[model samples]
Target: MDTIVYAIPVFMVMIVIEIVTTIIRKKDYYRLNDAINSLSAGMMSITSGIILKIVEVTIYTGIFSAVALMEFDSSELWVWLFAFVIYDFFYYWTHRMGHEVNILWAAHAVHHQSEEYNLTTALRQTSSRFILGWLFYIPMAIIGIPPLVFFTVGLINLLYQFWVHTRHIPKLGWYEHYFVTPSNHRVHHAKNRKYLDKNYGGVFIIWDRMFGTFQEEDEQYESIRYGTLKPLRSWNPVWANLHLYSDMWKDAKATKSWKEKLTLWFRKTGYRPADVAAPMKMPDIHGYQNYDPALSTSQQLYAGVQFFILLLGTTALMAVYHTTPTWFDALWIIVLGANLVMNGSILEKPEQAIKLECLRFSITASALAVTATLMPVASIFWLGLGSLAVLSLAYLRRYSSATEPTAAIES
Candidate 1:
């Protein structure tokens, strides 16, 4: 059973509850643009997962079948419990190394792009994690951990981490010492000098405490600063995923020595070629602000409406994804990815957003046309699309006057 899929409703409910609670408390934690971007990145991660999961399962299955150390029955409760702990043990190392290594950080950095820490921030996972992530769990396969056990425990571990990405929850008394709570995980996400590279455990905080990577959330010392040292100024999901890799590529190309180029990726996190590395300056945490391009009411409406529509499309895609041909699945991913890119542009209020949106709408319309020509599409879909397009243009026209001056929404 895909536990994560079954828990989607619960996740949505929790997010809504968090939003309402924060509002009721007279504190603002969720920003519309950041939340949308975070969710969009998560959507991309799911879409990518649909394609990459096959490779992951194949590799794990092949290795397990080839080397049968000892067949452990997954039906036993102890087996399940042991699998949970062991999987988390490996996850700690995988997550820790993800921060320490360069190429791995390229994929993991997407989760840290959002400056705001909220429930949606937890969903901002990397689409490329499957590339090297499987390496961590290969040990489980060698130890004869059944695939079913691994899958279920992995999902359980992930679901356990979801609730910790909020500020509403205070530290638990004794529970804080053993398990990961909101307080400790907040330190994990902090970019402050005192808290960097701390609290790498998933379900258990004991691992970090044991390994000396644990940092307590001390109010007297320094408040937590979320996000990486280099801010992701743009909201594009695709760029969010690839920006670090792009930086690494440029650094590699600029270096004179081949050894430097080859080893740059494997080197410590934030290590750049001497020629490329800028002088380190203390980060102005107080001056740091969230990236908020002043979006007009109409622009915000357009983004919200289109994103809702795309969310529907994404849900539909997930429903039929497994039944569809591989090509159609790939096409669905491309269309959705492009939508996210254009949506990011709209949020940024870039000059090119207009052109990009036109191209995006045209692509969507053309895809519908092609799809209709190939087979019968429901009339309701066409009706919805036509209504949405008309409403979008009307909103844009009505709100055009408000966009003359770009106002940055200060954090």
Candidate 2:
């Protein structure tokens, strides 16, 4: 919990520094509103992730943490250095299998489905990673990497990954040959035909080179697409993670042959009926696209400024919450319920006027979370009603953009 408690303040400082640095460098490509919405989703998803971490860290790492029984500072400097590489080796296989197997990909695919890549994309991780994720860490226990060492090194490894998600950094040349620099990591995130399944290294590039999965960035294939060929195309992060599962389940049930059913489940991601293979013909994103998403100029400017202020407010809320107040509970109950409903809403109409609706959502959610900070809730149940109302409105308004179809890009 100290991690959560201190993290708010620390992440606040970091985000402020990042935002200000972006402005100073004239590199603010994020639409302000989308940034806030994505940040809110990321924070909530991180909260979800930590809940699962409690299971992995306490339950699974409990095995290694019990290594306190073995008398040694096995977590010492040289020991930890070795453990990091071993952990990376385990991670490499697990990550490789995730690309090959459909079930595993469903969980991992959530991270790559974002069309926009940046610091936020790094945060756009899978909530279900905890499911198969412990398998990768299990090797640490066998190797006698103590629970303390296992936990600490795990955090360090994960933190090292955060910097690797950026397009801001170019190739570190020879550094790419040793460690998993941003250049190598960018290739890992690519949806391009040739780049897929390459650069599977976590912290070290040697893992990929040794495994024969390494590929250098190609100047000829200058374009890189961030999202999967078929995007989730929804604002709801929860559904974003589950949509592939839902599609796969539907496909598995619909298929006539047992082989086809198995193929539907494990062959590849976004696999579906021949009639529903929209992803196979999806438009290719050519040229340099990063940080910037699909919003227009006016909406981009508006959303970006709103994101700046709301992020400040979110950080402040975290800083101030010494005691979980009635309104805080109320706000969460309402927002989380609405968030789930938003997930179902997207799967229902993957092509909808979400950009317009998101502006409204950010305004309302910010108002509620902010108001709750000041006013104690009369009833948490009432927040549930508010969530329901908002969800219903989302349903009614989803496809109201007839002037321009949601799928059509209007500049």
Candidate 3:
């Protein structure tokens, strides 16, 4: 049982509170497209984790079973505390290396892609981190830490990092020295020359302090631009995960030497072969603008409603993925992924989004209708999906004309 499942409601409540607080303070911290895109990325990560986590746990458990150093008593308080602290220590290196290494940065960059620093930015995660991230925690298994203990501590460490994504929280005097606070974490998310790759702790700031990676949020520097040096200018969730890898592949193919092509991903972050490396101008930190595609009121409402529907679908998929049949689980995952892609497309290209939405809704409804007759699915499920499809199609049809071409936005 993932503890994060239980914390979803709490995460939503806190996000709402943060939004309200920012509104009351007149601080422009959140943007609709950015938040929705962040959450879409998060949904992709969680849904993909339904399968990825099993592989992670299996590997971790197998390692622990094979090399038993000395098992600690799981019931002991000290064991939990020690595991929690040690987990952060390992997380520090994992995070630090994520900045230094190119391939690792490709996965980690998803979290920092959002130009706006807010609660949703915390939810923004990479689905592909499981590719290499699991290697970082192998020492825990070697130390005979129980899988349950390791998992719980990891979740706790993750939960602790969420609140620190907010900008509303100011610097805490002495507390900032010990824990990963919003002030220090802001420095971590910053793309500024002085703040890049600093403060890599998950929960404790001490690891960064010890490793000489800590940098305070400097007041003298112009406002910290929150994003990668190479901006991910689109809101497409699938593209968000694939864009960096795609760039690397293109770089590898264009490189003159085979060794440079093979070793490109392992090179330092932002490394490119000289032949393919084009001199690119970095965005002026003081004048950087976030990626915000304009959408009419109707289009915004359509995207918002469709997003909420997909959110419910994602939540349901997360809840029942283990107990469901493999094919059914795969089907839901594909549909949900398609939903995310369509939602992002809607945001990026509103002119043609309604047609895409209608096509998606029609296909989904028709599939559900066919599946219900062939399987023992509950009547309520059919009714709910059927109603959603019908209503969504109607809504799209009603607003199809409003989303007409004005200016084409790049995706």
Candidate 4:
């Protein structure tokens, strides 16, 4: 079983606690649209992982079988501890290179796109990181670490980092020296001049300290600005994953020399061929503003309800994905992805939100009806989906005229 699947409930509970804590303290840490968008990107990543993760594990197992130096005993506690520590060591380099390399950053940038540093920000992840991220773990396989051990430690490292993506946690004086605390991880997520590209450890900060990438969160600087240098101005999850890759492709095509075109992706982060590089102004961090678009109460409620349905669908898919037919998995992924895209559109485009919702409901209903005729789907499933569609359409239609014009905070 995937360890992350088991962590979902704990993640939800922590998010709820964080939300309540922020409310009690009167802190403006969470935004509805941004939080939902973060989760949408995360769900997209997990759903896509249903297939990609298999490829990753297969490749790792193949490499281990062919070239492992020696086999380690899986039952030994020492072996598990060693693998856990070594995983973090490689994670530091993998994460650092993710920022230093252009193509890698294209995928890694999704996690940093959110302006608010809350619990949901921790869930914000890239669907495409599997493209090259698995290469970093090849060392473990070569060292003869069992795949199960590697996978388990990798999950532990990942789960450890989640709690650090918050504002409520303060510096733990001595512990900060060794582990990746919220203070140091906060610097990792910040786009501020001094904090950019520092603290790349997954669970341990010693890697950053030893390698000279560590930057403490300074009180002298104004409140730390969170996000990438070029803000992801839209709420679209698919675009969030593709925008940087798209920019890189456009730059690759526009550059004059063939060599520059081919090498741009391998060059340092944010590199552009001089011939095609436009004169862009550096962002003023002092006046930084989040990318928040206005939504009416009805629209917000619609987005929330729709997102909850999508969340339940994603959870159900995750629980049974390994046992289900591949075709079913593929279709579920598609339906869930489309729903997420439409939900993002509803958040950003209020005038068209009702229309989009109606279209989605109609298409879904039609698809379910067609599937029911050809397959063994339960009548209860059809009944539930029909009820949801009717109630959702009626609710949206009732408040369709109240949605306001799209408004956003200017950067």
Find the candidate with the highest lDDT and give its number: 4
Task: Quantify all predictions' global Cα lDDT against the true fold.
Answer: 0.84, 0.62, 0.84, 0.86
Mark the 10 consecutive residues where model 4 has the least summed lDDT: 373-382
Model 1, runs deviating above 4 Å: 1-4, 278-282, 350-353, 373-384, 400-404
Error of 1 at 364 (Å): 1.0
Off by over 4 Å in 2: 4-41, 62-75, 257-411
Please give the RMSD of candidate 1 to the true structure: 2.1
Q: Give per-residue CA lDDT, model 2, range 361-403, as digits (tens).
A: 6745574656554544322323543653455465446334432
Question: After superposing candidate 3, which stretches have Cα over 4 Å from the reference?
Answer: 278-282, 366-384, 404-411
State TM-scores per candidate.
0.94, 0.70, 0.94, 0.95
Q: What would the per-residue lDDT of candidate 1 be over residues 1-411, giving only the tens digit for each residue?
A: 233455666877899999999999988788889999999999899887888888888998889999969879987999999999999999999999999999999999999888999999999999988889899999899989989888889988998999999999998999999999999999988888898899999999999999999999987886677888889988899999999999999999998989989999998888888877874566887688878888756567778888877776776667666666777678768888898888888888744555676788788776666556433332333554686678777765655544555778778
Alpha-carbon RMSD of each model: 2.1, 6.9, 2.4, 2.0
The most accurate candidate by TM-score is 4
User: Model 1 compared with the native: what TM-score?
Assistant: 0.94
Ranking by TM-score: 4, 1, 3, 2
**Compared with the true structure, what per-residue lDDT tens digits does model 3 show for residues 129-206?**
888998999999998899989998998899899999989988999999999999999999998989988999998999
* Candidate 1 steric clashes: 0
Candidate 1 lowest-lDDT run of ten:
373-382
Candidate 3 colliding pairs: none
